[model samples]
Target: MTTPSPSPRLAGHLLVECLIAQGVKDVFGVPGESYLAVLDGFHVHADAIRFVVNRQEGGAAYMAEAVGKLTGKPGVCFVTRGPGATNASIGVHTAFQDSTPMVLFVGDVASDTRDREAFQEVDFSAFFGPSTKGMAKRVERIDDAARIPEAVARAFMTAQSGRPGPVVVVLPEDMLTQAVPDALKALPALNPPQAWSDPGSLRSLRQMLLQARQPLVVAGGSGWTPQATSALHRFAENWQLPVANAFRFQDLFDNRHPQYAGDMGLGTDPGLRRRVSEADLLLVIGARMGEATTAGYTLLDVPVPKQTLVHIHVDAAELGRVYQPALSIQASMANAAKSLEGLTAPPDVPWAEWTASAHADYLASLNGAAAAKVCEGTLDMAAIIRTLSETLPPDAVISNGAGNFATWLHRFFQYRSLSQGLKIQLAPTNGAMGYGVPAGIAAALTTGRPVVTLTGDGDFLMNGQELATAVQHGVKTHVVVLLNNSSYGTIRMHQERAYPTHVLASDLRNPDFCALAKAYGYEAEKIEETSGFAPALARAMARRGGTLIELTFDVQALTTRQTLSGIRDAKGH
Candidate 1:
């Protein structure tokens, strides 16, 4: 019996089919002229893969990152070469910093135009060098079609292994249209061996942890599965150690757990920093110990010696790259955590005293003015998070943009379930506005759950066009915009504090977001008074599809929450 040959179309379809087999349900991209062939391929399997058309490639890629963070799967984004791929660099870098898994498929210029400086023809491998784990260019031979699964498998493996990140696969326009043999149809399953710590290293780490009167466990980056988190939880509970999340990775630990010490990186709880610095041993896992995680890399300020650092990360490059460590183990976070769990016998330490201090500090931090006073004349950001926590199902995913408003949500909003926690999908370092709406759309589409995006007036305007996409796709996402009628609320606050006499390029005039949403064919409403917020939110969430609620609040209502510096540097301060 001879095996049947697969047509080019069939091969393309099978490539996507394997993606579906791997649990990929949502794909974010903006179709361009170059990717029409792949787009055509996608059209055949539209039911299996939900395609979301984003207004910008960067936004689409960021949306993929959001989906990946929320779902714990490799988020996929498709793009055309040249400008389309270039625009996605921000998102790629974001996934790198956040350790989120993502697969980026870029449509390349034809092989004929490879080096002719053809339109939209740039070396994608060179372009994505620093941002992605792996980059595969278009292969011409029919035999290379089988390599598609290998490329994809490696991409996913790189994405989920070590320091999780984005991986790019470039398909030349011609290659995507090539025919292949049927024998290549069966996708190879990827099962990389788990990287375990050496028995001697594990023993040394266990002894260090056990002997320390004050030991702290710092969690960061990605590669934290349910099993890894569970092991950490069990270890923390067994030894009564205070567990602190590395900056943005707070979602990995249960906030309600008595041993949880809250976030510990930049703008972290100051009290938590004091506690970490005072610890005799710092057991760092998965985290890169980046400058942000180490508060500008001032590891000594925390009063811990270089010899006290026991750093464990999947990437050897990351181990001791920032903070000198007495011991560094290059292994998988899950495997390392499991090994540590077995090596360490329970220690007799004053767990309650450490926990009591942390709990007291957390309570004090919450009682600050930032947590008090619900919105005066508009929807209070804090109240909205509290209400959402109370109203939404435990497993609902929430995606947020980077802005002053997001800071409030981060500090006040508590996740009952890991699946529903806040995800910083886009690279927050760039602090780009207008990602919340599209990201919310992507999250809802990917997770099949209610998606809530918290944005400010300035941010909503940046990506406001996405409301139409949401409505067109029948994506039921709730958009809550804090209408401060100002650009850069944090900057404005800083100006007021530093140079009270002058305010420049900070004040803003925004259009009526509610009216704008209505123009985009969405159910829209405006809430100016805090009193009507609950009823308005209920109405919005009850709607079957998209709803935009603009909450107008005074600019003075801006307050710092979950931030390191209470004030920024302006002319005076």
Candidate 2:
């Protein structure tokens, strides 16, 4: 018996079918005339996959990036050529630096337009080059309609393999519209190949651990599953090592663990910094120890670290790219963690005292006498973060963008753990200013869980229009906007430190954030004092539709560590 041939279909529909076959449930993007056929394809296969319409390309890209970070799969996004691609580049850069897997599809001018620079045309490959310094890991254009499945499969693989990052695929408009007769089906969903730790390397690491009097474990980077995190927990507990999460990835280890050292990132605890610098052995796992995590590379010596660094990373290229390690293991997080946990430890290691003291420092950084002084304002940001940390569910997801305001969230909120089976924190290690709102919306829509987006007035306005997208999708995300009437709070803080007492372009003539949120069909209120926050938070959480809480604070509440006056006074102006 002869098998029946597949009927001819538009290449766009074939592309959508390929995506569905690859297990994509949701895609985020803004509509464009260039991809109308692809949009119609989404309508035809609406039951198989849902296309989430976003307010702008940037928000759409950020939402996709969030999905990548949350799900461990390649998050998908679509946008038009030229301006749309440029606008979405920020999220691509974020994904690259954050090491999250993401795929961005750019609908381009018709095939006939070629290289004549047609309307809204862009050389995507040139724009998003694949290199050590580029935005994407891979960039390709599909000129033939029949190769959609191949291009898409390759894109997904390239995004997720080794060190995860963003990939871009360019689809010409005319090629998408062309009908093709083919029986092509998507390749089976790809799983990244796991590289296990070498037995000799593990033995070497154990020897290093045995020789050290003081040791620290820095754990973070992408390609981690709940299983990996659990294995990491077991390994840390077995060795009695203090584990410090890298940069914005604070949830990789439970903050409540007895041996949990404070996070290593911006606004890191001073005691923890001292502890890291003083440690004799550094068992660095997964983390690349970028500028933020390494405190602008001042924490460790460049090229060759002063400490005995045993670095393990999935990608061999990253193992010795920044700092030369005494021993390097090229292994996936899961495999390395599993292997490490199997090593038998001595009844009592030498670092028990060191680990306990590290945990003590973490506790002191939280609220003990060693913690920084409280912000001077009616609406105390630190206290508010403490309330959020206490009131929210253990699984509640928190997201924030770049600002001095984010320092409060990072310093005060204690992240539970990814091993708890949820990714609780979504912030950009790249320090992008407009990531929180869209990321929170995506988290709520995808996970069906409570999400709180903390944003400064300037950060909120960058992608605040995405609030409408959340309302349209019936997502329950609470947004907290910290209003200080300054558009560039972080820049202003730096300015005060450098050129004391001179305020330049950082000040903002702002609008009523509550009214703006109300315009987006949300229940909104303004809270001026600390006394009004709890009740307002309860009301927001109880509402059916989403709500926005605008908290007002003075400029004196500059950061967790210092006030505006304090910064200028230090400069002695």
Highest-lDDT candidate? 2
Instruction: Give per-residue lDDT, candidate 1, residue 245.
Output: 75
Provide the lowest-lDDT 10-residue window in model 1: 134-143
The Cα RMSD in angstroms, rounded to one decimal, for candidate 2 relative to the true structure is 1.7
**Model 2 misplacement above 4 A:** 1-6, 368-374, 481-485
Give a tens-digit lDDT track for model 1, residues 1-573: 996654444456656766876777778889987667667667888988878888888888878877777656788998888899888877777776677788888888877778899998887667666532432212112225557777777777767765667778777777666665555654554654567888888888877876787777888777666777777777777677777777667667777666677775435667877887787788888887766677776755433364388889888887756567889898887787788677656646655587667767755655535544434444566666667666765555566566667666666655442423344232243355666777777777665677677788877777678777777777765545445545677677666776764789887877777777888887877777656777777887787777777776666556644221233333334
- lDDT against the true structure, per candidate, is 0.69, 0.88
What digit string (tens of lDDT, one per residue) describes model 2 on residues 255-334?
A: 88999998999888999999999999998999999999999999999999999999999998898899999999999888
TM-score between model 1 and native: 0.87
Give the TM-scores of the predictions, in the order they appear.
0.87, 0.97
TM-score: which candidate is best? 2
Model 1: clashing residue pairs?
none
